[model samples]
Target: MRDSEKILDSWDAYSDEHTDLDGWPHDDHAYGLRASQRDADTVGAFEPLRYGARHLLATAETQLAQLPENTVQSRWVYQLGVLHAALDRLDELHEQWLVTRDALPATANPGTADFDDALAEHHAESWSYLDDWATHGKALREINTAAHKAPSALVNAPVRRTAAQK
Candidate 1:
């Protein structure tokens, strides 16, 4: 098997063994998996990030769908919208990266300086999405906490009205 395949297979085994019922691994385990793949295969390493974005998108969609129509002031509704937007942007970037990677000649030399520079650029962009994702996640958690602990505060908070609502 190719090195990328082997790396992904190991990751699958580790994820299967470590993930909770929600399919989220502990932070340390996830960091370890990323560390193992970072130097080996950039494309293969991006699989987890893509999967995570998809998962969050689906979850946010579900949560938004489940909310009642009258929940205009609900913090969760707003937070889920933010989460969805962040995930969507991440997904778009991943697609662009795939197109760029696939457009490279199959016979390109991996050891060339040009190849190394391109790989570095792609890797940097890929990892940058993590910062955006984490920021959105932190915001979501804060919203959840506020919604639970001070429900009245969220209820009274002014929501941005859409043009339709205005």
Candidate 2:
């Protein structure tokens, strides 16, 4: 299955397990009963991204560890480059949110409508970045698949040690 299908499939299972005992009223006469939308967007988005990224990194690390001595260097370079890019996107957004929150007036902390607006703007932009990441990430995933299949041919020659290196 594709990555997003894997995510939502798992989420559906999780949602079922965490289902609330009580739910909105249902009526046979009414055709328009709508389900309540849980305001768990923060938990919903960030957590899976985190978990998936973690899974990918750990898998890449395991693959790197299993590589032949002469080839280990190259696979790690590809994996680490992608891993760091993903992390960099997340880290920048986290820092942006943290800095914005810190600079906010202490009195307007979280629940107020203005606070919600600010957060909405923050999250909206972050989601846009995520959309772009998903697009680029799909392409990178293909590159990774190729890299994994041909580590020796795929890896660039070793980088020269820097002057600062021990």
Candidate 3:
């Protein structure tokens, strides 16, 4: 059984890494793979996040499989899976941003339709992904916090209540 705190910490770490992508200047031309499409740091940062999300998704799936359906654990697992999926989707969106950025000419003007359109699409997608991440993150945090509570307000409430009476 993975501790809820550790799981939350993993998510927090990933979120911290995600900030790197969020503030990435697609049009700055000074950061990311824009200057060097093959930049190691640019690709390296995102790869781990994707891997972490995939790992969390797999772990949640396995845990969910071992447990019964329609249970509190099942719900937690499902939420965690959704959170991981959001992270994976963010990774995909970042890749698309990279592709579009690379396709535009170095002298591409933000005022021009071609550059503006591509950049706008990437920015919009990034914002959407960020929103999903926030939503899922809040859900997971609530679930984890509830799980860590001594009373165990979940399906095991009865067990705690019975133990308390004794």
Worst 10 residues of 1 by lDDT: 139-148
Candidate order, lDDT descending: 1, 2, 3
TM-score of each: 0.41, 0.42, 0.42
Consecutive 10-residue window with the lowest summed lDDT within model 3: 33-42
lDDT of 3 by residue, 1-166 (tens): 1232343355456445544666544345443322232222223333444455566456545544444343444356566766766676777877888788888998777788788667656654554444444445444444444434434336554544566688
Ranking 1 against 3 by TM-score, winner: 3
lDDT of 3 at 31: 38
Candidate 1 achieves a global lDDT of: 0.56
lDDT of each: 0.56, 0.52, 0.52
TM-score of 1: 0.41
Model 2 pairs whose backbones collide: none
Best by lDDT: 1
Better of 1 and 3 by lDDT: 1
